[model samples]
Every structure is written in C-alpha cells, then in structure tokens.
Target: MQLKKLILLVTVLAGSYTLMAQTDKNSIDDKQNESQKKIKKSKTQLKDAEANFLLNYYEQDGDHSPVTGGRGTEKLENVAPTFVVHIPLDTVSNLDLNFGIDFYTSASTNNIDYFEGRKTGASGKDVRSHINAAYSRDLRNSGNAYSLMAGFSAEFDVTSFNFGGSYTINSKDKNRSLSLDALYMNDSWKLLYPYERRSDGTNWLKDDKRTTMKFGLSYSQVINKRLQALFSAEVVSQTGLLSTPFHRVFFDDVNGIPYDNLRSFSHVEMLDDNRLKIPVSMRLNYYLNDFMRLRTFYRFYTDSWGITAHTASIELPIQITPSLIASPFFRYHTQTSADYFYEFGQVSKAMVDAKETQFYTSDYDLSDLSSTKIGLGLQYSPLLGVGRFKSPFVKNKQVQFKSIGLRTAFYDRSDGLNAWLVSLDFAFTF
Candidate 1:
C-alpha cells in the first residue's frame, strides 16, 4: 500500500515541524524580554535625575492668645511668621517631586484688642496675609499620584485652589490607597465705616463676594503589624456675600435701620450668606517598638444655618538616641455658635426704634465656642550616630533623648492665656 501510505505522510510532517519550532522560541523570548525592560528603564531614569533636596525655615508665634478683663486678653498678641521648602528625587525613578511655601503675618496689637477696636473703629494695619503652594508627582509604575494647591487671604476675603490624585490597588497581596479632591474658594468682606456720616453710616457694599465648591474622599489601610488607618470626607457649598459688612443687626421692632429709612450702625450691611459645609477626618498610627511612636486624629464639622464642630489630636514619641526625639501633644475644640450670637452692647432698638439688634442680630458668628490645647515638642539631631532611645513600654537598655541641633514645640490654647506657640523643624541630606 505504498509503504503504508508513506508512513502517514511522515507522521503529519513531524507534527507540524515541532509546532513551528516552539513558535520561534516564543518570538525570541519576547524580544529579549522587551530589550531587557528598556535597558532597566534607562538605568532607572538616569538614577532619578541625580536626586535632590533643599530646606529652609524661620519661625515665631509667641503669646498666641490669652485675654481676660484687659479687653479680651488684648487679642493674644499675634506674631506669626513661617517658611519652608523641600525637594527630592532618586528613589529608583518612579517620578516624585514636591514644592512648598506658606507665609502668615501678625502685627499682634493683641489682635486689635480682641475686636473692640477702640470701642468700634476697626483697623488691620493694612492687611493680614496668608499664602500657599504645593506640588506632587508619581505615575507610570501604575500606582499613580498627583497634587496641587493655591492660596490667598485678607480677612477671609481669600482665594484658594486645590487638586489631588491618588491610586493603587492590589488584591490578594493586600494593598489599598485612593484619594480625590477638588476645591475652589473666594472670600471678601470689609465692614462699613466710610460714608458721609449718616447716623453711623457706611454703605454700598465694600467688596462682598463668596463662592465655594469642595469635595473629597480618601482611604488607606493596614490594620495590623503595627497598626495604621486613614479615612476622610469633605463637602462644601457656599454662595456669595454671606453678610458681614461689619455686623450689627437688631430690629427691636424697628428702632431705626434694617431696610430703608436706615440709621442704626456699628458695622454690618454687606448682606449675602448662602452656605453649606461639612468635614470629616480620621487618622491613626501605632508602632510601639524600637523607640515608641503613636498618633491619632479626628475631625467633624457641619454648617447650613446651624453649626456644629469637633476636633481631636494626639501624638507621642520618645527616642533619645538615633538622633533624638520628643513629642507630647493634645488638642480638643468645640463649637456651637451662629444661631445669632451677641454679648457686647447688645440692647439696641431705640434710635426711635432701632438701627439693629434685638433677638436676631449680634452675629459674632452666633457666639458659642470652646477650646483646649497642650503641647510639648523637641527633636535633636546628629544623624543618630547609629541608634538610641527604645522603650516600647519599657524593655530595658533604651533611654534616649539626646540633642544635637534643633526641634521645639510648646503651645497652650484656650482662646488665650497670653497665647503661646513655637515650632522649629530640621533635616539634611547631600
């Protein structure tokens, strides 16, 4: 039969030539593993552009606030000045960049005698300033990241901008991180005082403006192996000039001014307050070993006619060696004002009826506040000759708290007590 049909046609041509020689050795081992992963990602992006870093600072803020009888504790003497900068690159190339700047000023005339302003004559030396800037980067390796922020200020007539980004998800092996933010703000309000005298005159809106839109969501987790947690939420929606042209609202059934035929004036007439605000935050970290470390945080606030708030913080660190360390912190605050507050010269409505104030005026942001604070901070450095400080509760042989340079924090708060605060931080690399 023709040699058994030529042995089944050479066994189907030797099984299709060994399946095309193993598909050409898997296409030449996938092009030599994509050309050695693009030459190891171009030598890790040329050693992460040669890594970099920079830092600078100047700080002061003493006698923060402490007033009693002496006219609202003389506005707690505000002396605030700050500055900082940082840069880094070369963590094996995964894109990482950062920028910074923040400035604040206080001529501290006890914050203008805590608002009385010489019984009503408001002045701010010219202007109070607040500035900000930020930046972040990292993408490609997939676990993306992005950030941006802007700032401005002048008695809340500030301007702000924001942007955020984060992503990272890995299952089974466990890994999570997600973040989002988008914020915009505008604020302006300069109470009345300049107008050809008219029974405490001052009208024609100063510069009232209010605009807001904020939203955020965050997450990070690792509940074990040293503990860690983070969660966040935020929302805000405000609408234009929420009234405060100096502030003074009383009708006592119309003693004088509140709508035409006006007269009563101490301040306030820039009407327009449409708002909605909400904030929620949380953070926790624990690592009580090798040198102890602990942190906690919480925040909750609400707005929309009625107001509510809460805040808490805690920190603890004690490492005397390995470069020194010291931390002792505590914070707590409470709020419940804005239902229409008052307390100064409160009874008005008889300028033949009223210019403002009588059960729905005062508005010191609705008065109702509470506060608390205690702190201690210190950090010394010398590159930690190697290591020091260890007592995860007390494990013997580990008593560290050495000093080499700078690190200080001391603050006391309760509205005033002569308000005091100080902070100085440091780092170095080359």
Candidate 2:
C-alpha cells in the first residue's frame, strides 16, 4: 500500500509539471509582451521564474532504542521528495510554492507493541506531507523587502499549522543586510501509548496540543572582495506535551510487578511539558583565487531543560574543471545531558520517590553525547547547454538539462550509534 501511494504521488507530480510546462509555453508570448511593456515603464527588469525538484533517501541502524528503555533496535529508513516553484508576479513582487512528502519506517516505533508477543512487532511506517506558500515584495529599489508565508503539515498521528513573516533591509551597495523573522506553530497529536500501558485503549491522552513560537534575527556583511560573514540568533519556546508517550522508562529497583510478555518492569516516560531554546550561530565564507572556496560555521545552543550544545563545521569547494566542482566537509558536535536524563534501567528508587526529580526520562537523545560527520560532494554544471530540443506538445518551447550532483556522508556518535547516507540530485530548466 505504501509503495502504491508513493507511485501515485510521483505520477501526480509529474503530470502537474507537464501541464505547467505546456501552459507556460502557450502563454510565453503574451507574458513576454507584457513584461516588455512593464520594463519600458520601469528601469528594473524582471528575471525568468524558476522551478526545482529534489529527492532524498536515508537509512540508519543503531542498538539504542528509547522505546525499549534505550537499549534495543534503532533501525529506520526514510525517503523524501520535494518540489519548489518560483513565479514573478511583477518587477518587484514574487510568489513561491513548496510541496514535499516523506515516508519513514522505524523499528523503535514498532516497539510500542513489543509486548504483543509478535516476532517483529506491529507496522511502524507512516507518511507525512507538507506544503508552504510565500509571497515577497520589494518595498522600494532602495533595498527593503518583506515576505509572508503559511505552511501546513499532516501525518497519521500529528498535524501542524504554521505562519511566519520576514523583513530584510540591505545597505545601499547591497554588501550588508539585516533580517528579522517571527513564526508561530500549532501542533496537534493523537497520543498513542505502549500497548501494555493503555488502560482503556481509548483514554490515551488528556491534552494533546503543543504550541511553539520563534523569533530570529540575522546580519550579514561583506568585509572584502573575497570574504563574507553572517551572524544569526534565534529564540524558541514550546509548551504542552513535549514528551513522547510511547517511550518506556525502566527503574533499577523493580517493585515485583511484571509487565506482560516482557522481562523487565517499565513505565511510560514522563518529563516537563514546557521548554525554551536559544541558539546563536555564525558563518564565514572565503573565495580563494578562481578554483577554491572555504566555508565555516559555528553554533551554540542552550535550553531551559539543562541541555547545552556546541557545533562546528567546515567545507572546502575546489573547482576540478570549468564545469565540475568538488566539496569536502566535516562537522563536530557535543552536548551536555538534560538534568532529568537517566540511562536504561538505571533510574534509582530515591530519584523516583522524590517529587522534584519525578520528571525523568530514559531517552538517549537527551543524554550527554558527542558526534561527528564527514561528507564529500561533486557537482557538474556546464556553462553552455549542449543543445535544446523543442517540446513535442508546445511549438517553439525548448528545455535544457541544467546540472547533476552526488553526495555521500558518514556520521558517528559517542554513544555507539553510526550511520551513512548517499544522495543524487538532478536539475532541468525551461
């Protein structure tokens, strides 16, 4: 069924693109004439609109599974496909649309029914779909622009609605800029608990809503012809139902009560419902001669739950040929654990008895950890098209192949988890 759904989705997207291409071909002449008239009235001319498509695949395997009290299978796989379209409404206004879907399966999520006495547990696959639309307008040629966006996401057990806006101001020479953005989201979830813990199967969650608000500010400056820098800061706050209901927590001292079909006694995970997060980051890029460039990034993050993290990364892009580029990158990150975090089957009776420390979790993701990732990528883009062929259905309309890219990466964590990923991207233009 999932494969069928994926195939149907791809077919619909392809059909839509074909229809759009035909429509654009039919209206090209009218649009060109209209654009010429607008250009004659204004000094600045509009550029051609563009559309892009991207597809990604990822898989991972690890031994720690939070659903099994942080020590079981943590295998997962995911595939995502996305499409973006940008249209110029006028010389100073534009509209953008993005649509995406993700299909994922997790062995850890399947452990929610581990006690059901099944060899592999129940199905843990789900599909998520989302769309975003935005409109941006230049207030004036003097370097002021504003944009507004709305987005929605839906999955089997969760739905989210988001709204956001951004304002940007650029210096006269366009070498310096500042941007401010604000966003709000409302997420609703159908809380599903572990099979053995659901008392009345129907009475899963009393409150299943989460609300988040975020604000961001950024500044970019061009220091010289070859160097540029950007700094950004963000504040995020979330409230209500922040913990996963299905994740289990085991105590060191068992109370002689045995869980059904399981060797260890476990309870549903619990934690505080409110959290606040702040992150600040900076990026620097340098162009060296005509064949090489360097990019560096650093970030510091902290949260009210007593977690602190640091991240740093660097990438170097080298031009192998006029039409080919190679980039290699590495990143490192480390974080302090949340105050209420405990290992699998390691929670003490004293901590459980104390009301203040009752808000605890055995989720490894909230524990102290260090991680590293390294990757390489190659891109091929020709300066001039090899050739262009007219569309069979639209007279005088031609399309050209643009570029291709391939990337692979390896990720390792201090907590005995590792993963590898590879991806390919292709682009075309009309």
- Highest lDDT scorer: 2
- Provide the TM-score for each candidate, comma-separated: 0.25, 0.85
Query: What shift in Å separates residue 322 of candidate 1 from its native position after superposition?
Result: 55
Each model's number of backbone clashes? 33, 0
lDDT of model 1, residue 70? 14
Q: In model 2, what are the clashing residue pairs, if there are any?
A: none
TM-score of 1: 0.25
* Residues 1-430 of candidate 1: C-alpha lDDT, one tens digit per residue: 1111111111111001101100010010000000001124553443312111222222223222111111121222223233323333443222323333323233332132323334232223323344444445455465555555555433333333333333334333355576665656555444333222223353445345656666667787887889889887767777765543333343345443322233323333333356576777798978899677788887887777566877777877667655556667676667776554434334444642454522333433234655555556555554332235555544664533222223223333343322344434322221
Pick out the ten consecutive residues of candidate 2 with the lowest summed lDDT: 26-35
The true-versus-predicted C-alpha distance at residue 367 of model 2, in Å, is 1.0
- CA lDDT, every model vs. true structure: 0.41, 0.69
